[model samples]
Target: MYRLSGVVKRYRRGRATIDALAGVDLTIEDGDQLVIKGPTGGGKSTLLQMLGGLDRPTSGTVELDGTDLARLSEAKLTRVRAATVGFVFQNFNLIPTLNAQENVEAALVPLGTRAAERRRRAAEALESVGLAERRAHLPSELSGGQQQRVAIARALVKQPKVLLADEPTGNLDENMRDEIVGLLEKMWREHGLTYVVVTHDTAIARRASRVATIRKGHVKVAEN
Candidate 1:
């Protein structure tokens, strides 16, 4: 679960100060599914970064399970991210040289998982994502959808408590988009993950129990 209060993220752009998150107050419960929608420069992704402990806020607090991420040391934050959160991105962010299985195993490396256990877990993750047959394929060798599935496998291989996806289906066609979204939903249910996604697709928004619209560093949440 996440509880963000008075979260403010400010960046310096030349002489001007840009507030990516002016003051965000939000709560996400365990097993909750939330979709964040907003304009290009809005604070959606910034907020996601806060939740995932990928960035520190300029002011206020971002708490996950009662631990304030903003207060953690970099070493502790890295450990929390490695053990608690999973990320999927629009670009897939796979290493072109690494095969599907290797990319998934890479996630476990941060935890100092042994090679044999890493291989077994990565294979099971790829199988769960319907990519077992493509384990040996590199990112360049797979279709866009397949590549994204590999990304999903990599994210979930560690059995993270929360899944944060930013524009996960953005690069796919309509059919493929639907497939990926469906797969995400299935994984959320089966894994009991607290899912938060930033997306522009209205179809994906419609499926969420709650939708948040963020603009100009402000956020407004609505129930379905």
Candidate 2:
């Protein structure tokens, strides 16, 4: 579902230019589960951003479903991100003031989903993540695992075609990490999502059908 060709992302740091992604070429098929592993400062997250349309490449193309994201106008790109991509991050990225349910509903706001429908979908999404009972809880009131579940719920509430997770289990303990990873896998299967995760955990990498190791803006893929 994703075709990235000659993708290059460069950032200027003072007088020197840094290449976060240097002429990378990758393909991610529909309903595929991929895990990206790399050290810090590698191009893993930058590549994820390209896939999610959160950032544009300095050169080359990032195509999703035949449309090049790099070529879209900002308005069209925003609509694509709202309607097609879902994101989960290492830190739960929840608003402390919003309750679990509200956090999930916030995702639908960008799509202009009406309030009543948003509530229904958010409720179902939370239920799917096993957070139905904690709907009223604030991020500060929930455990780390529970907070991450809320984040996952928020990401999936819109029923996006692709799920992009960056370091999703990084902050959790071993047991919690397993639980979260299992939850992600379950969601991927049930939702038929094209899942791409960036993680450092070898255990998570071992579970994937394909693993990609990226370093110094270069990427190498291997079958698990």
User: Over the full model, what C-alpha lDDT does candidate 1 score relative to the true structure?
Assistant: 0.96
**Local distance difference test scores for all models:** 0.96, 0.96
- Cα lDDT of model 2 by residue, 38-97, tens digit: 999998999999999999999999999999999999999999999999999999899999
Q: What is residue 39's positional error in candidate 2, in angstroms?
A: 1.0
* Candidate 1 lDDT by residue in tens digits, 1-224: 79999999999999999999999999999999999999998988998999999999999999999999999999999999998999999999999999999999999999999999999999999999999999999999999999999999999999999999999999999999999999999999999999999998899999999999999999999999
| TM-score of model 2 (CA atoms) | 0.98
How do the predictions measure up, each by TM-score?
0.98, 0.98
After superposition, candidate 1 runs with Cα above 4 Å error: none
